[model samples]
Target chain A: MSVLQIFRKTIMAVVCKPIAHFWFGLNLLHKERLPENGPAIIIANHNSHLDTFLLLTLFKTNLLHRLKPVAAADYFLKGGFSSWVSLRLIGILPVTRERKRGESDPLQACYRALERGDILIIFPEGSRGAPEEMSNFKTGIARIARQFPEVPVIPIYLQNAGRALPKGKRVPVPFVFTAIIGEALTYPGDRAEFMEQIRSAMAALKEEAPQLKWPEQES
Target chain B: MSFPFSLPSNTSLTAIVLIYGLLGLASLIYLFQKQRGGGSDELAARLGSWWVIITLMIVPLMLGALPFLLIMSFISFVALKEFLSITPGRMEDRPIVVAAYLTIPLQAFFIWLHAYGIFLILVPVYAFLVLAYLMTTYGKVERFLPSIGIFHWALMTTVYNLGYVSYIMFLPGGCNGTAGNAAIVLFLLIATQLNDVAQYVWGKSFGKRKILPSVSPNKTWEGFIGGWATTALFIAIVGPMMTPMQFPESLLFAALMPLVGFIGDVTMSAIKRDLGVKDTSSLIPGHGGALDRLDSLTFTAPLFFHLLVFTSYGPFAMSCS
Candidate 1:
């Protein structure tokens, strides 16, 4: 609601949309895989920054649920203009993913958002990986799902986001892409079994989508 | 029972300009509200400015019917081009199919000449038969027929839909005629757009059951009914003033408008899903693109136009009398 924020959003609504139209190609398929309401976790592989916008477009808002994305705090939550632009203007949530795993909780805020009956989008790979492969998922999403077993954990594949804005690249290259795919994994009560299910579900997501790379094993 | 009257002297033209300016203001306010927290695209702002300017120029020229029709025809041409560009047809058969793009201007011209007789037949019967014949004669039947046929049908709908709306505005009532006609157009535009907004609002507030989980997940039964009910109420209030119909009759028309408009919205949604696009293009701010704008028009225009025909031209008058 700040004046500068107001000014910036108007420009995007008018300016960036046309350019996005010419550059980025967004395809959403089998959107029926995600349920329409309540306590669902959307898990997708991370690739490019533009993945955020593409996901938002795929997450249509009618009257019920509005999709909120969990962005890395270090990158998008730097305060001032950038944070305002990313969080307030673009409707994304910023989480500190760079925090030490045991010492700090990266997904605490995300879990809080979920507990509050909000839709959460988590990039399980933890960081943006090359389009060729998905990295190992952080265990935090599983823990959150375990705590709230009733919630559906939806898996999504974001095709061609890496090409749009790859790691170490500032400029975006337009490659028409699809976002909505993969079925939601219903939670089983056991933790180890659930993690295995998640891993397998994540594998199947990458299997059918041969275009995307499987997650590299942790070093 | 007559609505308050007005003549198109300098005062009325000035009034028209002011009303248009207010509409520009309304669009801005709408953009601000939706995009307040979200970052705005510079492109959307620039295009929106252009849209406002065109709207300003367009409404005043509506002082006369013929000039108004010409201006509208030009808009339809631009709109149709945008539609074709987004929804690509056959690749190899581009040459012969491109001629169909000519139909936009041709239909406009026919409308200008007030040749309703030919205008009605030019697309559906004649154009369809001819386009089908051309595809078969060329013997590229396997590869090109379907795309060519789809392109022809799309063009036909685009022209027919837009022309129907323009035809309504051009009816021979003179400047004062515009006031009454504006009411009809306004009623349709308002009802449809409000339904879209209401569905979004209601869905956000209390949506649960998904209507079409695949095509549009956000569309809930509650939201749809809520939007329809609200739109019906708005239509009932405004309908009689715009048309010669009575209140109950107007209510009936208003009740039907949103259902048609919702269908138009979903039909376009299906197309966007096929094309894998978010918006048709970034033409309209807060709104989306030409197709996004025309989605409602597709249903609203033909339905309301025919409704006008039925009430004014058909046997309804005798029964009412």
Candidate 2:
């Protein structure tokens, strides 16, 4: 394994997995559904900075080397320590959220990574939001899925991550979080239809465990 | 510094050997059953994991007090992390969470220093008050009662109660005769864990009538009584060898230890039931979380600690001077 891959594995093993298991009480369901081989797209509803770590924790150790997260360049690759962490430690593929005057296509980075047989994690919602509340997905994932029709797009719904670390919080509170991985989807050939399918699939997962519903939805 | 290869006395050695012999025989029977295609893969996996756990536990213990204390602290840290992870806490409670994590090391440090006075009050008295004040600084009363309660209870059960195991090493040698402090700690672990196994086995074999159907449906009266009797007998036979307690006190210790350990297990089950999760986390393959593995220890450690201390120093031992 490469040094960066080794570093990522060590961080996940020593730091992320333990913290996720111990501090956040992370439970992963239907992880067996995750394909054991080949490239795939993992799309999830982002709730906290923890969403990335929580999702990564679900995969077995050896599979981690094949996993590359697509992160927002504006936030993660602004240069300096954050850029180092994004490029070196996590090995994230930084996709520029905002297109600059003469900059290359952001999707090109993601497309090439997927073509190279890397399993990519993408939060189609674009950024973090409140728990149980989902934003409309950006079409970047749909566009990428269209380009790589052979790669499966797996949808994951993360519950309670917002309460664990939420946006704007440096430290996370311990809250039991669950990651529900839905069946992988082949791109339906229509971007809007694909996005809807992904969204509905995530919504359908919320019904899997009634107890995991948001407190407001209980009564 | 010279390390002792053997336990302080022949009694302790005999007790260890007997325990290992029983485990070896159980593994042999399990292997035989597997050959006949009558054994479960789950049981086989559990036995395999138990070998690793036993080695991890016994080796450090053999190294003496500091290693044992460090291991116990690491367990507490993991257990507390599992406890907090499963329970819901708000983002506003971040400071309190940090404080909770910070308390683990300090608590272990106090036990390491043998500052019994400070160690005793560190979590119950000081960490409680400090964390409560820290929560107030957040100025959020949305989950005031529950938030504070979760933080306090997590510390008490995970950090403070489990810390008592390490403190077992600090118990005055006079309390345990020449069997040594390691013997007492090992005795508690053996009785508590064996009680769990006996209860499960007896429950499967002849259990009828639920003890607490709502909380833990699998727990049955037959298992409870059978386990209690067996564990109590086992302790009575082996206890004197490990602890300074004579027959009557050994009998009392054995009886109470299992009962308390049962309560601890059931209490954790109730919490899991309320939270709608099976185990705390799946850190251990067949065992569930660190909390699952250490549940019985949480209750037995503190109760046994006080019982041994009081028995040794009499009623005035509360001062622990």
Candidate 3:
């Protein structure tokens, strides 16, 4: 493992696990549905920076290196300490959100990362809104899904993470988060249909959040 | 080996055996029900958890005061963490959250030192002023009063109240010749916990009228009366044997402790009702979160300690430190 990988592992083990699981309380469901190997895309609803930490901590320590988050280039890749943390520590596959005029595609980094068999974490909502409140899903994830038809699209509904660490908040208040990982989705039809499918899938996850049965009883 | 506070080793050993024996009886009931093809998974799970809980309580107690202190503080940590996570927080008052987490160990440290003077007032006096001031420093006026109120309240219930349970070790023990300090802790724990069980049993069997319909529908007057009588009787019988109290004082402690535990339970329910979530978190499989389990204890511990101090510790000066 590389030095940065070791540092990331340490953070996941020491800091992130306690803050994300114990302190913030990540009650993960359907975690077994997550593919052990990648060439996979983990799409989630955007809410808080805590979403990234919570998701990153889900993978095994050795597999931590292969887990890469697909974030906005304009925001995350802007040079300095944040860029360093995002690019190196989190290992985000930075994609320029704006339409750029060039022969090269904006999602080139994501495509390259996927081709290399690295699991990409994508937020279809593009940006965060109010806590636990979600907006319309962007088509960027659908395109990624269509391009890599074999790659599994895991829809994770992170409930209450927005309350933990929402946008513009540097310090995170302790709030329990529930990350509901849905079953793996493959590109079913065209881009728009796939987009609609995942969107409704997330909505289904949200509905199931309250009624979902947990085997937490003593018996 | 001698304990920091005098709990006669033999007395505590007997307490351990009795606790284990109770656990064994529970297991046997579970087994019998299984044989009759009427075993519930919930009962099995509850028994499994009780086995662990009983063992955890007894072993640390045998080890000495420090282990018990560690267990109590850990519980406070989990309970506080659950409280903070469940409640909605303002972004501007984020620093105060960190301060809240910091208070757990600091309070525990005071207990380790047996610095009753500082331990008694640290959260009430210092944490109150400092946390409020910390919120003001952020200079965000939106919901300042409510945020401060919530922060201080969280600290009080989770850290301050539970800290009293650990402080019981330092209570000047008048019964040190026969009973150990462990007996006092066990007495409070048993009375409070059994009161909950007794109340649930009574409520299910004969509960007719509701106490606080909107707040906690399950709590009925019958359950309340039955639980009080049962807990008070048990305390009166056991307190004289284990604690430094006569029958009447034991009865008094019994009457108040169970009542206070009920308050704690309902208060937590009110918080849950507002938050729109059930069972703080699933830390314990059978029993909600640590906070859920400790809710009554949080209320009972402080009252139990103060009652002991008022009756036994204050006049005794030094019993067996």
TM-score of chain A, predicted model 3, versus the true chain A, to 2 decimals: 0.91
The residue-level lDDT of candidate 3 at A53 comes to 80
Best by lDDT: 2
* All DockQ scores: 0.02, 0.33, 0.19
Better of 1 and 2 by TM-score: 2
Sorting all predicted structures by DockQ, with the top scorer first, yields 2, 3, 1
Give the per-residue lDDT of model 3 (tens digit) for B28-130: 9889989999888878877788787777776676666788888878777777777766665675555677898889889989888778888978999999999
Q: Report the number of the highest-DockQ candidate.
A: 2
| Per-model root-mean-square deviation over C-alphas | 14.7, 3.8, 6.0
lDDT of each: 0.64, 0.81, 0.79
User: For every model in order, what is the number of clashing pairs?
Assistant: 33, 2, 5
Candidate 1 per-residue C-alpha lDDT over B128-244 given as tens digits, one digit per residue, 9 for 90 to 100: 776667666657655465466566657655777768766655454432234545544445555666777777778788899999878876789888888888888877875665555
For model 1, how does the per-residue alpha-carbon lDDT over A104-196 read when each residue is reduced to its tens digit?
Answer: 666677777778777788787877876536777877777778778888888887665665466777765434454546777866877777777
Query: Which portions of model 3 show Cα errors greater than 4 Å?
Result: A1-19, A22-24, A27-41, A59-68, A72-120, A127-135, A145-154, A159-175, A180-219, B1-8, B24-45, B55-57, B173-175, B204-211, B220-226, B315-321
